[model samples]
Target chain A: MDFVQLKKNCKKDASAFPGYRLALLGDCATQHLAMALKGAAYEEGIALSVFDADYNQLDAQTLDPSSELYEGKPQGVVLCLCTEKLYEAFTLSSDRAGFADATFRKIKGYWDRINAHLSVSILQFTFVERDDRVFGNYALKEETSFYYQVKKLNLLIAEGTRLVKNVYPVDVDSLERRLGRDKFSDPKLYAIAKMPFSLEALPLVAFETVGIVKALMGRFKKCVVLDLDNTLWGGVIGDDGMEGIQIGELGTGHAFTELQRWLKELKNRGIILCVCSKNNENTAKEPFEKHPEMILRLDDISLFVANWHDKASNIRYIQKTINIGMDSIVFLDDNPFERNLVKQTVEGITVPDLPEDPADYLPYLQSLNLFETTSYSENDRDRTKQYQAEIGRILLEQSFESFDDYLKGLDMVAEAKSFDPFHYPRIAQLTQRSNQFNLRTVRYTEAEIEKIAGDERYLTLYFTLKDKFGDHGLISVVILEKRERELFVHEWLMSCRVLKRGMEEFIVNKMIETAKEYGYASVVGEYIKTPKNAMVETIYAKLGFTDRGDHTFVADCATFQPNKTFIKE
Target chain B: MERNEILEKLNEIFRDVFDDDSITVTEETTSSDIEDWDSLTHITLISEVEDEFDIKFAMKEVVGMKNVGEMVDIIEREA
Candidate 1:
């Protein structure tokens, strides 16, 4: 496959929908590979910019900072060294330690500088071994020296990547196993095309690199539609009964328990767990509720529609019940028939390839690597409990005659705080994910968030909500960029759990008051429409914002008028 | 065999694996030269080539096949 075609496929994947900005930086050895990426970007609908440094004059700092060369805020950056060329750079400089540490430190410095300058994810590449004779230069003969240097550089980069949470090392060696040698060795193709690696290698890297970005960007499926029977346990609950099922302490039963434990972790991360099994509802309910050793519970599940219906239809009902998109769902079942049924019926649902061995369950589940959440809030620990509390609140709503009476009974408190370094990582994650209630779903990396913090014109607000039930954690994030006489609300998004809590209004009102104090004449905001965010379509309109076509809604600070019954605590 | 036939075969391999018939295989064609040609597809392409050409490529050889011409040369030698 060509890199271009693979890139197209990547764009089609739900995870890379809005796509990301990618920057390619490499030595002369990778010139063709870089150009091929540009071509791939054109075909795949992904935005990728390639930068080629002159081989004769290769200085990282000398490269133009503002040169649209690096203009796009790339989610991932690829840095490569042709083994022989690096050997040349090593020999060219008389001070070995100077070049060694300087080169390694420069890579780290690049990330530090970029973290301050660019709002994107970074991916660094290690050097691949080349046939010694390929290079015309002779002093580089101990090619092993360059190989060791490259390996050392990769380890250093990996260490740096580990330290900075946003950086990733895309080791070509791991990629080579998946893609063979014939495709990777063609120098002519690479030299001319700017893609010298195997036809197989590029897409894997492109997808993997993009996967890393998507993960860093904090965009992942929100729900897992599970099939009972062999999925949740080793055997069927109806036929085998609770005693016959294997879902208890260690050994054969322990594998299933481990899986259930994994599911518990997934649930804790705010992934709504829903059971869509084709069995007696009570039977399925027994394992979750009555089974003493069960890791997940009836309350743990957001929806339970266990009837003998087409699994796809059940999944559809769950999606609607949860008020989420079909794309944000993963269907898991041991039965190939059911998995195939859902895959054929549900257009966007991700059905991972399940293997035959029961022992393969952990690896199979791990392989899916489906959910990639970068931001974990304190609320994440008790997500199931909080959501259940929301369910309880729903039940109490029926008893109350008035909305305020119900609100007053709950004793809800909404607290807004300024962005602190301790919460920056999760705050940045919220910016990347949290789609539905988002004013403008502007995806950003933590590095970029740090940069935004330094700029005085911007304000990043974090909101914490709790009632008598439990702490809902930091659930909402709003970013405002202010200019002379006016403040622009760059981003505003709240966790779906806190949607109806009147927190959005409270935050907007806070922004308005803040703007007034700053002497800004008006507060401007935008309501960008997305496939899943129709819930917030009339938010600005309801808050007394005037529509300024093209989805930009504005509110004049002085003239703004709205019914406010905010009981701030 | 003529270089053109070899190129055509290589091009067919790229087209079939990439699922894009429009790709014309030049001697200089490499993964970076084409889009959608990432590491995963690179493996798929190599496996397809192994089945097509009936040749086993070593780690170094596979890594070395940077372009269509290089892939052709490696295949012809092994074949």
Candidate 2:
């Protein structure tokens, strides 16, 4: 749905949407963009409250320390500017190339000022050039052409964002290609209302811009569950056999090749892949093992559940194994019956209606934009391997009679201490995305983590566990605030993959160790109950802390001792 | 459809858009007459009218609208 429909839905039932605050800064009239954004945000479960400055108030809003933009205290900020206005500014001086340098300086200054003062995620747009023939195609080479200048500015903006902490460039160039520039702009509107973009394109811009906002707010998918047979390939695997299955660069099968290749790319980028198909295990595994043309291999799949069982139950098992929210999974099946069944049974899983033809699958999937992430690190490349190792560990646990015996046999070593540059992004990500085992459920941005890393009054610890199977990369974080005469546990978050493996016991033991070493009288912890965090609700009491009402618990530091554990510090 | 017929349909849309069943708009009525008719909500009203009447409105037409009658007149012309 576009902005108009979303706005109408929100207006019909405003209470259904959760409130999010945003500051809008623009060179031209931005009332339409602000309205469209709120509607789009509300559609994405963010009932947006906007703090938009008047036209041409970008300087006043960012530079003035006491401006309303600062006082409003928005969580996300958006800046929208077009080349028409920039071109107008350039014409004031015969030295046109100077405009490019001047504009860059102004933008970089705004970036610096915004960074210094606000702790908000800034979402800014790159210019989509107006196809004016100031120098025709030679505008491509001319440094003075507004088109080339905007292109250079966009590149600089992207490079600067890569280095700068919290700034993100929303590529309007890509969006303009998607919706043609002629369709996206209106000359009459630009002339009268100073609105460069057309009414129809406002929703498109709002939707893309809000994607960044949603990523900042920790509302995005993590896994994509797929169906084999007609879904992945053009033919059924069980009936068609390995050779009979339509695949490779021939026939209608090439579509399946395209789909498989895309899915593999998503897996490599840290999106977990799983199979929920009704087929014989050998038949399903046959293609990946024997077929030379298949793009996806066994190693790329984190979990494969190809069986006679209903897909909904298989999806539940996958969720239990992954320990992520149902909202974080997108299920794809060619069969409408299967899709509807899973949709009804699974509360929050996204099940898009697949087109009748297989050719449309890739384009339809692309439009959903299922996998959204804030940062990419080296750790992401081996995510499928890590999850596969986790599954191996789970299977090994089934063999041992006692869970403790399984823990002891694994030979686990945990590295726990204050944060460093290497673990900073994952550490911040854990705070943002982790829900079930998160104590207090406080989400932190990378900027806030940088602050926490250096603050003396707080103890910021990151934990990484590696055992016989593989390395569980940087799994847990604990932030302890030093109280007057005690050390209060400000936050304790853990990756659920490492849960029930004596890691929690080691973390708590370490907290008490710090309290005793620092000569603090007591160590306190709190468990805030969220719908998803019930598993860790009574965690403090289980660890032998005296329960105080209102989700608070405390223990004497002097009396605390290490629990039995296989982990070596 | 006649203007009165369109008004009947538009009133249904107004109630749905505003989330208030009691809301009844007339030719003389403007955005100020309704409690929820702000700049943000103006788009929702326009969208609902367009959908119900199966028409489109220009940016200038939407922004330049003075009252319910002007909106109805534009929709009728387009229809």
Candidate 3:
């Protein structure tokens, strides 16, 4: 999008969409950046209200407790430290050898002070790489050169931000590298006004920033729904046979191989991969099973649906089986007809316009950054196996005559315990990513999760499930705030991968048991409606709680009977 | 390019940047005559004009251009 179009988006009505409060602090002029951010967010169906701080007020706003930033009560803060200002500071510094370390310390101090005052996510922009060309090629050898220092500072920001739980480093340096420095920055504009980014680059920078904000708001892609034909490989599997499909080191085949490698890495990082094809199941399975050139195998896919059905309906079925929101699924297809059909039929699905050349596929998709996430843990790597196990349970249920007998045959086991430090990452991840099974849909960061675990008034429970198939690690999270006579369910969310199992029944039983043991009179639960959370609209009623006219439900602990489940807790 | 032609193009750009279709700029028009044409919009307006005429306004021209007539002179000379 251009500057004019984005500026026009600022006037569009965004009241119906979800709103987010953000404070923007920068060392340079930020008025245009704020406008671009709000305008870009509007296109994504988000009403972003930006509190644009004055120029060069990063220290003042963060250091002072009574600053306007604190008064605005923003949920997130965006810090933009431009390369121009950093270069000036570097040139003026007396100790050039220690510049990077000193700069990083000051940046970390800002994060420490702001976090001490307010528990909000910080979107820290990495410095755009600039060189004075003072040492030319030898700049790489000289540690004191601005080029070397800036590169070192970027690395410091990346490693240091990871140590802070809530600071997310937005890689503006990488963006500049991709767009080329000439297009990304206009020196004349910088000289005229303190604007670090050119008018053309503001929209893109705003886009990347808003992507993180959206992910923080629990709106991010969870699964990639892929096509099998010309999209994944070179030719049709049904016609080309396993040997004829191009997906190896020969010519354009390497492109498909690279794309597959990227997709496999994403799958390893916990994004579920699924197959939806129009060819017969055997035809699609032949390449994945027997083709030596294929980078993606049957083991990588969580769900495979290869039938001659319309891709839109097939994607919906895949979504239902996987139990993720339609918005969280990104459908990739080379055929424009199929892409248009899915885009028009599905309400919130993301279907990118795949380029005609297969060689351009991976780069174009990477540029879109479809799968932006806020948290990751070791448990994420096991997500594919968990979903694969869910498919196994589903198939086993079909062979059984009765539902209860099928659940019993699985020999399910579960554990519900208070939140511990070891399981905090996975627990917090569920609260942010879970949508369909989420009650109240309250997203929390790891820092907030740690805070809640330590507070005495809040009771936290994390649930894990395992069966003969595999283990679902830390699948559910519950936070209950203690009232004088009752325990109010502050937050409750469960992974959809464990939906059909008796996990909810087991968890509800544990909640009531815990309440009675703590000498509480009653347990109360609530369901707040979101567009993607309709699956749990009547969860409080279904779990046998008294509807209290409001969106809340209550059960007297003394009179409550425990829910029966096949799982042995 | 003709002087009148440059003025016509500048009028279109001024309408677009100011987000006011009723805006019309002649040789005598200046920043004070426009309600929303402040320092920020002036930058946007100059950028828009530069892109429209396929030219780059020097830093001096960006800040020192006094009126619509002066902007038209730069466009005519650059285009």
Best by lDDT: 3
Number of the top-ranking candidate, with TM-score as the measure: 3
Tell me the DockQ of each model, to 2 decimals: 0.08, 0.11, 0.47
What TM-score would each prediction reach against the true structure?
0.58, 0.73, 0.80
- What RMSD does each model have against the real structure? 11.9, 9.3, 8.6
Q: Tell me the number of clashing residue pairs for each predicted model.
A: 58, 0, 0
DockQ of 1: 0.08
User: What digit string (tens of lDDT, one per residue) describes model 2 on residues A1-569?
Assistant: 65456555445455666677899998998887887787888777777888889998998888899899988888888888887787788778576776666787788788888877888888878888564688899999888887777777778788878888788888877788888986677665676667877667888888888887888778788888989888888788888788788888657988999999999888888889988889888889888888989888887888888889989999999898877899889999999999999999999899999999999999988876667667889888888887888876876788899988888889899988888987788889999999989989999988899998999999888888999889877999999999998889999999998888899999988888888888899988998888999988889889878898878899898777676689986
Query: What lDDT does model 1 reach?
Result: 0.70
Write the residue-wise lDDT of candidate 1 on A1-569 in tens digits.
45545444433434443455566666644544554565455443355545544442224432557644346555566665554456667767676545545567877776777677676666776656443343445425543344445556656766777788776766665565445655554543443333446555655555555455555555468888888888788887899898888888633777778888998888987888888988988888998888888898887787778998888888887776666779778888888988898899888788887788767887777754677555567867766665567556765676899888877777778887778888888988888888788878898888887888778889777889888766778898878898888889898888997676677778788888878888898888887788988998888888778888878888888887744644365
lDDT of 3: 0.91
Q: Of models 2 and 3, which has the larger DockQ?
A: 3
Expressed as tens digits, the lDDT of each residue in A1-569 for candidate 3 is 88878888899999999999999999999999999999999989999999999989998999889999998999999999999999999999999889999999999999999998998999999999888899998998999999999999999999988899899989998888888998888788889889999887888899999999999999999899999888888888888787788889655789899899999999999999999999889889988898888899999999999998899899999898888899999999999999999999999999999899999999999999988889999989989998889777877888899999999989999988899999888888888889899989999999999999999999999988889988767889999999999999999999887886788989988889989989999999998999999998888788878999899999899888877799997
**Each model's interface RMSD (Å)?**
8.1, 4.7, 1.0
**CAPRI quality of model 2:** incorrect
Candidate 2 clash pair list: none
| lDDT of the candidates, in the order given | 0.70, 0.84, 0.91
Considering just chain B, what TM-score does every model have?
0.90, 0.95, 0.96
- Candidate 1, superposed: residue stretches over 4 Å from native: A1-19, A31-62, A66-68, A71-76, A81-103, A113-119, A126-159, A162-197, A215-218, A248-255, A268-270, A290-305, A373-379, A391-569, B1-51, B56-77
